[model samples]
Target: MATPIYEFAQIPRVDPAAPARARTRKVRAAGQAPTVGVIYNPRSHRNLGADFDCSLSPHVHIAQPRARAQLPEALADFAAKGIDLLVINGGDGTVRDVLTCGQAIFGDDWPEIAVLPKGKTNALTIDLGIPDDWTLQDAIDALDQGGRVWRRPIAVSPAEDGASAAGMSRVAGFILGAGAFTKATQAGQSAHKLGAFDSMVVAVTGVWALLQSLFASRANPWRKGARMRIGLGASGVPMEHSGHGDPEMRQLLFASTLERLPAGIRPFGALKNGLKLVAVDQISRRTTALIPLVLLGKLRGGLRERGIHQLTASHFTLSIDDQFILDGEAFPAGDYLIGQGPELAFVTP
Candidate 1:
């Protein structure tokens, strides 16, 4: 049985507040002739599906479908080709890589991104309404028709201290987090060789890892639990220290880009162009609480009053016990602090 949502009170609240957003911004509408770059990561399941529908797109200036050691080369090639929009055909990791690559090669004036939900858990793409089953022909057709595409702002981590200080340290397109949730994702990825592309499978695997860590991992998780000292914000304001303060003790601190999670238990205002911040202390209760409310795709029986779907934080960081997963890919610097890494900018479909 899962624990209760109230258990989250065990988590210390950070000064995280709602994201302050102005009107949505757009770089290129559908009709504009935006030169496209296709940096497909063939290794991920999402990019390999449906006969490589992404690679076959007529609009994109295609490069080899892989994340090279020195990714800047690929971006240089695309930029040299004058590609205006960079279409990423992979999961969250791939998307993150693309952002870094863009920063390295193009700096702040980089191409906008269009994602193909070719990842295991396409939480962001799904939020963007990029269908689970998309065809290249359809996308091309839509672009030709100048379909009404939606645009959303991607979050950027506060500038860090380094050669690439202005570069993105972290960019959350769909979700960013620390704590047990990150550990769970890292653990689940250990079995990546035996994993599937389906979101349900990945979620189950992530949960398995969470349980394993709770019960068996060598880490001292139970006594102290996973806690991080972070500051969150939105609309460019700090949301990390007050009635909406940072959590003193949290098992999982997550900020999501979309309103809904699995089974359509979307956070409020996610679809309305905002992010959601949730700090979790007891997974069992959260699981239970969110489960019943997930009736097909709508909330029911007093479940809707549980939490807010929209939250914002500008400077959020954590001290974690395990490596966290950004989107789906795990990093080598997984164990250390990534002072504001990975930035995400979006493109309308």
Candidate 2:
């Protein structure tokens, strides 16, 4: 069977009023091994059908959750053990599921995280400068010797009206995209089957998307975009439209807390850090032709006037007529509040 991308979506809604468990880092004695917990996904691109090596010390605990329902139990068990390091041995989807389930358990006080880039798209690891060959032993050793990189995952919650009666259903992830981005993600999957992974997949899908937009008519999905309203910050200020094409429809919407993407693409231009976003209006083919330069960080000036809007905000709201993607998983179309999750420390060499 194929790996299910919607595993995180199966997680039940968490109550808003329930008191979150306070997570505290485990302190090891001198010369003692630090307690480690690993959430290993057997279905990850690199780990498929391979048995996990069990030669490690007893201090390292590994959990192979076959479904999303088992993630919370595994994470809670880790918390009870006072694990010093939480290693995610999978790609972005696995990271999203772990972080989402861990919210109720770890709250904002999480153990130092170490990600082994064992998936097709390891965007978070790329941002943390983790090498593809990083191993579990390396992560344990890095706990003492390696540097630390701080990052915040983007937190997405349903709008008040669309929320569950108990509370809003929230999911945490690094990359969120809609409009043409959703189509590109679908195309990326096709590239994966052709044996293209990581940056190569990005290049393949990006070039394909650009070509489609350049040659297709305005009625095409690539050029027509999606109908969505983007509100900036807490005040819900309307995002300015450049009067390029249809003011009501945007050609693309991409948001992320990660600074470095897989292909070194800079969609946010000069705006880095915080919650940065790029919203493109239903621009003309002439403007669509400049997307490469914009993504390369070369076409910076007068972007807003040319139908490209790149800005940073504490939070943003989205009301869309079509489905959006978060960490390669599709979410139903609805209103949502997007903000940054707690700052997490990632172990890096």
Candidate 3:
């Protein structure tokens, strides 16, 4: 079956001429109304047929970029207008595209950002405390009165010698997962078919995977996991292996820069800043049954003996023999360098 695309309601398209008018400007000032630019994605699940409040004065500019390639042009136009606040109007995928494309345009000096949680999954919003019903007006108001949360996105790039044939090697996002995580993402599709989304989907798939791993034989896919070598920091020091499982393989590898995650899963344990990852080695069935409690922070100590390891570092490298999921997209198996991007401030209510 072809994959289904979920789009929320879309507002009427903004006038095509508005961008040109918006470009006729200089830089912003302390007292002037801050110039705002919005990158609206009409295809986001919660954005289908939705109407946005477009009457935010003349200083506000909006652009609807239909594809990922168009994101760079849209962001470039915004940068040229000297926008002070960059509003992203979709989900995590849209945010990833904007960050990846805007890197060349904004360099190290990025404008303040706000996100509207109008998509199937808004994990970033969960961390930022953005309301589900937040609108453009709310985002604008928050720009001045709201709290600021600083976060750095995860940067993924192919190793110099491992670049693909097309040389398309770099992308920036917030979440990364491998091993059973890839299967869990595949299972999430089924959860979507059942009308589940957000944390509910996470809870459902996580529970199902736990049961499967707890009961299935050693030969089962969930039990078999994936072959991976994890290296910590710049020196590429090998991750230590627990004697309970295969020394070279990890049953699960999940990494992220966001603090709060959906379903209250604390995969990073107590390590909350920068790049954090949890690697699970193939283990006995008893330990598999206790996995949920481990994630809930109920079980402590002897985790390494149980074949679970959580650590934080400035950066890391992953050499894997299976595909992994970044945000919601699947990337080919190879060597990758994962590190922190610019620390950006996100406006929140």
Candidate 4:
């Protein structure tokens, strides 16, 4: 049998001459129900093949896309219906797929988004301050009564001249990581199998990563890191090196538009908001020993000299020799552009 090639949904082309549609907030009149569209994922960790309840409201619309290829049509239908709220009933990966597909239909004008933490890793929900037990009913009620939090997902695209840039498309996601962070993400899968999710998985995999990096020799994959180059801002200025281990290699690179992280870890140090990134170069074991404190915001002094670099940028370009983790999935390695998507209003209790 021939190997199957899976095709994901692509963003449809829009006419340049067409006027941009205004995405004004729809205010419901007294006793009026808002139009809602939900994208539910049955394969999410918590969903676990269970059927989603579809008898919520007359105005509610639900589409459970079994694969990513079905998202575009579903979102197009929602856009045609002029839904006031867009509910994503899954974990981070589902959110990534929904947003990436919706870009063509919704563009910068998106309906208020609501996320239910129903995945093995709900880091985005932690940033949104959503409880794990939140339901569609809770999200619906909050549509009118709850507050709105503004967030921008990180948008990643292949660089025009990148090796694999021929037919790659832009993807929207909340978290992006590479190098040993990629290895840690792989370990998180095992943690999930042991009944760990969210913060517990973070705690478990984090300790393992630290131990592996601490006790192992510099030649270990955890310490050797991946070879990559980062260029900061629109001008593409080369990122400064801290003169630690090999200047061309970094042990880890983590970037996100999220201000808060699961387990309350502060990898970006004092930097908050916008697109924040932390790059770690191979360092002495003494500095590696301080990883816990560094994540706890306890050690902030002389971090640059210690081979830890954290900063916020409007955008950045990454060229890496290894695959990177976005949300929970991995993307091929190559030159790529990373930036923030439009600000999206998220309903929160």
Residue 162 of model 4, lDDT score: 53
The candidate that wins on lDDT is 2
Off by over 4 Å in 3: 1-31, 51-55, 162-168
**Candidate 1 lDDT by residue in tens digits, 59-174:** 56765533334456777777776665667777766665665445445544555556777766676675566776664444444444423334332443332332232232433345
After TM-score superposition, what is the CA distance of residue 86 in candidate 3 from its true location, in Å? 0.7
Please write out the lDDT profile of model 2 over residues 248-332, one tens digit for every residue.
Answer: 9999999999988889899999787889999999887888899999989999998899899999999988999998999988888
Better of 1 and 4 by TM-score: 4
**Residues 1-349, model 4: lDDT tens digits:** 0012212224343343454354445667898998999999988889978886678777899999877778888988888888999999999988988888777678789999999999888999999999989999899899989999999999887786452432246688899999999899999989988999999999999999899989998789899889999999978999888888899999999999998999999999989889999999998889999999999999999999899999999999999999888898888777888888889999999
Q: All models: lDDT? A: 0.48, 0.87, 0.80, 0.86
Over 4 Å off in model 1, which ranges? 1-34, 46-60, 106-112, 146-173, 187-196, 202-224, 233-248, 267-272, 282-310, 331-349
Candidate 2 vs. truth: CA RMSD?
Answer: 2.0
Better of 1 and 4 by lDDT: 4
List, residue by residue over 2-34, the lDDT tens digit for candidate 3: 013311111112222232223234665666788
lDDT of 1: 0.48
lDDT of 2 at 96: 90
Q: Which ten residues in a row have the lowest lDDT in candidate 1?
A: 1-10
The alpha-carbon RMSD values of the candidates against the true structure, listed in the order shown, are 10.0, 2.0, 6.4, 3.4
Q: Model 2 clash pairs?
A: none
